[model samples]
Target: METKKLLKAAAGAMIVAFAISACQTKKTATGQNADPAHNSMNSVDWAGTYQGTLPCADCPGIRYTITLKDDDTYVLKTRYLEKGDSVFTESGTFAWDENGGKITLADRGEKFQVGENKLFHLDMEGNRITGSLAEHYVLTKMTDQITDRYWKLIEVGGQAVADGSTQKEPYIQLNSEGNRVEATGGCNGMGGTYELKEPNRISFSQLIGTLMACENMEVENGLKRALESADSYHVQGDTLQLFRARMAPLAKFVAKGK
Candidate 1:
């Protein structure tokens, strides 16, 4: 009877030890504690501009540049080396693969594997490279956001803004300090505070404009409506595009200074 009691106690102690060890075990990709979820990538993680000098069959090389915006849209710019000054540009949407480790261009179905500040040119079959030229197929990221500068209103709802040929053009200045937004509301002097809610999300509030109504009231009204409706923004090269909640751009601005 005493031996039986001892056996029970020993079994209880063994169970306790096992439980403690299990509690300390960390989950790994192949471990018993691993999670079933896979392929998690947010907009900020996948959005950026990537560039590389890709090999070409006819030309010396192709300077490949692709801008990945948070809106799932992408712009592909390519320049043929030793060919001409002509630049080929294409813009469309992109989708992530099942693993989230790759993105497929919607227009051409080309696949690119995502990595740390790099994108690998993958085969159409969406597999990793195993050849001598594998190293050269990688593109490095140039940064996703642009620096703050004086941005002049260039386009309003897809129409090109006049270059002050007749009237003075509208302009805006975004100060890095305190999220202040100052601009010419096409006809009046405007000032406001902006909120950068996220990498892609932005909001403007407390906007006030002068009452000195100018001749171009239509332009002024358009600018005010666009600014108030803007909920997101994207900076591509020298251009800044303001968008309103899942819709097309409300306004587009270009940096005036070098």
Candidate 2:
């Protein structure tokens, strides 16, 4: 009986040991953990495109454009400038490093140093870069701010322009450098500056228009009032809607892109 009990106890011990070892990280020939088991997903709030001209060994340059998505997926587009306009794209899931300062591409044995609005390419061994062209390895983040260009008025408070109206087309363009706007009030051409007082609030300033007397004065005056009263602005697709405080949009414009 004692021999049987001892044998049973030994088997149980061996089973538990095997289970524990299975739960541990995978080991390589050198007995080191090969797979990074650290889940550093919460390391950075990075999600956007990073683009730069990376130095190449054989080719003239590699135009690298990498976009990181919110779902932890990434799309890498590489363009060989010297080779041709041909672009090679690769996409896969990525994980953050144990130190939370880097990201490792699971599919391609590659890594990158994540920084504020930038990324630094790393080597195969996941080590520091030591090269004369290391400075050019950095990629800059793309801006999300509204482009500084003219947007023609497409609508006003849910009203689109009537067909065959003798009144001229209305428009508004914000100055990129300053808080200024150049616009046309139905018939008269005008220009003014704008001030952003809040995260979603804006106000027009010193709006002056051509003093031409015309039959379309009604349409022009209405547009002028809307601009002066606008307290906020929202952009959707190619359309821009300027709004008054606590009310619907006072004016709307669409970008006539080049």
Candidate 3:
């Protein structure tokens, strides 16, 4: 009877040891105690165009347009309004911070915290700005499409292009089919080929327009000049702005009907 009791106790001990070992193996395989990592780089849909007007001391404001791509590259453009017609543009790869919450521009050393549909500008030390001006440092994402729509010229070189000033309101249409661009500069019909080299970079070529001249050719002349000089563009909601380098927009347009 004593031998049988000892045998039973030994079997029980073996079963308990096997069960504890299996439990530990399961925990290790499933990673039950590990914490999952989450950050803006993995959680946010951050690759897109962002734009805002930052405060400036000597000028009205600094217009900023930045484009971040999925390939870890970026394009940054800035214009100091009321200062001069010069747009500063920079492009290069960007690096994510250790925690993957922020990005530092490779060329400018500028840092921005990635957020949902926006970016928060950080100071040189990588801290968010404080006080009343903090709100002005945000850059909102732009999701509007720039092609296959009628863009009516609203302002040209800081001057408003009034409706009915010409036979046909000045407008441009970018067709995605053949990369063709068709326009009417308030009076004459114009056709050209346009190429979008990068996210915001654009160039117009093979431009040919009607030879007829109107009495007031101011709008037409300005529109043509804007098209020829524009090397970059910005789209915010229904508005489209064409720019050269980092200067102010040479021309601004609004989408008409859908």
TM-scores of the candidates in the order shown: 0.46, 0.44, 0.49
Worst 10 residues of 3 by lDDT: 28-37
TM-score, cand. 3 vs. native: 0.49
Q: What does candidate 1 score on TM?
A: 0.46
Those runs of model 1 whose alpha carbons end farther than 4 Å from true positions after fitting are: 1-40, 144-258
Residue 46 CA error for candidate 2 (Å)?
19
Q: Candidate 1 vs candidate 2: which has greater lDDT?
A: 1
Q: Which number leads on lDDT?
A: 3
Worst 10 residues of 2 by lDDT: 30-39
Which pairs of residues have clashing backbones in candidate 3? 86-246, 86-247, 87-246, 87-247, 88-246
Candidate 2's C-alpha runs over 4 A off are 1-147, 163-167
Number of backbone-clashing residue pairs for each candidate, in the order shown: 0, 3, 5
Clashes in model 1: which pairs?
none
lDDT of 3 by residue, 146-196 (tens): 766799999999899888888778999986546689998888999998877
Clashing pairs in 2: 179-194, 180-193, 181-192
Q: Flag the better candidate by TM-score, 1 or 3.
A: 3
The lDDT per prediction is 0.75, 0.73, 0.87
